[model samples]
Target chain A: MENLLDKKQSIIESALELVHANGFHGCPVSQVAKNAGVAAGTIYTYFENKEDLIVGIYDYVAEKITSYIAERDDDSLEFENRFFNYWRNFTEFYEQHPAIHGFYDQFLNSPFNSEKVQNRPNMWHEWAHMFFQSGMDEGAIRATNPVILSILVNTNITSTVRIKKNFKTKLAKTNVNLDEISQLIWAGIKTA
Target chain B: MENLLDKKQSIIESALELVHANGFHGCPVSQVAKNAGVAAGTIYTYFENKEDLIVGIYDYVAEKITSYIAERDDDSLEFENRFFNYWRNFTEFYEQHPAIHGFYDQFLNSPFNSEKVQNRPNMWHEWAHMFFQSGMDEGAIRATNPVILSILVNTNITSTVRIKKNFKTKLAKTNVNLDEISQLIWAGIKTA
Candidate 1:
């Protein structure tokens, strides 16, 4: 069972790399299987079809990020500290797995990401909603829809990573200040 | 000359729709020509190749957006008013031309948006940089990188549009509050 799981993961990773390099249509299931060093039939054993595999990749990355942040979350910390901590972990995760950015951008824009798929329960979004809601309840953040706040925070993190990735060399000279970004977001959401 | 210009514009519009519906690779030059009611050879007359055509689309959309905002921009207004006006124009543009969002998301993630391409002069970014820098100079906003400010503002706008587009039916019932978003952004960038 462990071996089977490992193979499934390997296929997802391979597909992710391919999709990142080439858009979804550019990468075929057969190519993904070849890249993963598995038989074409093996891919079907794991995923019902290409769409299923794409969603699997989404779940894989989403779980990886949410779990990483959830594990390090300190509920005892004040709302501001907790916000910055979440920002740091989120930025670090993306920095380490830059390929996920491309995959996500492509996935979000693709037809494969239908309204049905988006409405499905997403771990990261759920965590964000809970965190923001807690902040509002504690009167740490402004009184508004938690979903809006979550969107603000999540988009900030993703956009920061994207800018950093796109202008890596230019930014190396004058470092992309993560603290400034965190502060800006904190200011945006905090009670004013 | 006017007829020739219209033909070029029509080709670009058709290509944008095709690329938005189908990812870049899925839409070939031949299909674009057919959709535009022009011969395959005619597309080559205006654009050197598929890549050139893609860049042309970027320039076309970028100009369309920048000019729209520029025409309505009242430089005499206070910075806050100007900022909100810019936000309103930006949001309206996206609302009217939702196809641009999918095309941009795909283009940015694809190799089509290389560093070389990104470095090319963009009217929209140039306008944004100047606006933010002026805000900082007048002490209307925080003293930090204008690029950072622009990224925050731009990302917020794009993310808001994306969320609204993805959750149109749901958002219609809830009404994604533009005022709330603008206020959040204003609080983030304004001088304390």
Candidate 2:
């Protein structure tokens, strides 16, 4: 059982690397197997197919990202502090593991993103919604749909990370202060 | 000369319609010609190939969107009103012509997005930047990098339009006030 799990884990890691480097169509199951150092058939033993492999990678990356943020989260803190921690953790994870973000970008654009993919309830999102609800209750966040507020705040974080990644030199040259960004986003969503 | 321009315009319009419906790969030159009611060779006369056609479509859409916003723009207006007008124009354009937005979405994800495409030196962007600079100079906007502020505002517009298009039911269900969304975004970037 341990050996089976190891093989599955290796296959997933290999998929993430290959899919990140090359897109979904670029990294076929054959390439994933070769990179994983297992027989091409071995990939099938783990994932049903290439699409399945990609889905598995998505789940893995999502969990890694959410768990990292969750660990940094402290329920006892003020909503603002907790949100900052979440944002910081998310940005740091993307900064350190760009491959995960790369795969995620590709996955979002890929054909695999169906209703099933879109509506797949996520624990992280639930946690975020709960946090936003509490903020709304406390009259700290906008009374507008909590979902929209969360999306706006989330976009700020993602946008910051994207600029930091894609325009590293330009971002550095501009001397953008990351800390100020979260505050700006908060200003946008907080109640008047 | 007039006839040639009309044929070319028809081909370009047909390409946009088909490509937006079926994606770049799904709509070949032959199909565009068929939709345009022109000869297959006629498409070649106007565009060198499929990629060129897609580029032409993008340029056409960009001009349409920018011109629409520019026509409504008044330099005499306050920056806040001007920015709101820009936001409303952009969203209305996308909402009315979702196929254009669809094609744009696919084009962005396609391999055709080269540095040349990325740095096309859009006049619309220059106008936006100048407006942002003025806002910053006048102390109406946040002192943060104007680019970041512009991106945040632009993302809010795009995000709203996307949700409005893709989740019309949910959007209506939630009674999301589109006007309020721009205000929320502006709140993020506006100074005291």
| Most accurate candidate by DockQ | 1
Q: Write the per-residue lDDT of candidate 1 for residues B31-145, one digit (tens) a residue.
A: 9999999999999899989889999999898888889888888878778888999988888888889888767766766777766888888898898789877877778887766
Q: Which candidate has the top score in lDDT?
A: 1
- Give one digit per residue, the lDDT tens place, for model 1 in A1-192: 269889999999999998888767667988998989898998999889888999999999889989999998999988888999999998898889877877876676677777688789999889888988898888898776677667767777888887777666665443335557688667766787
lDDT of each: 0.81, 0.73
Query: What TM-score would chain B receive for each of the candidates shown?
Result: 0.92, 0.88
Off by over 4 Å in 1: A171-176, B25-30, B171-176
Q: What is the lDDT of residue A4 in candidate 1?
A: 88
The DockQ values of the predictions, listed in order, are 0.42, 0.34
Best by TM-score: 1
Enumerate residue pairs that collide in model 2. none
User: Which TM-score value belongs to model 2?
Assistant: 0.83
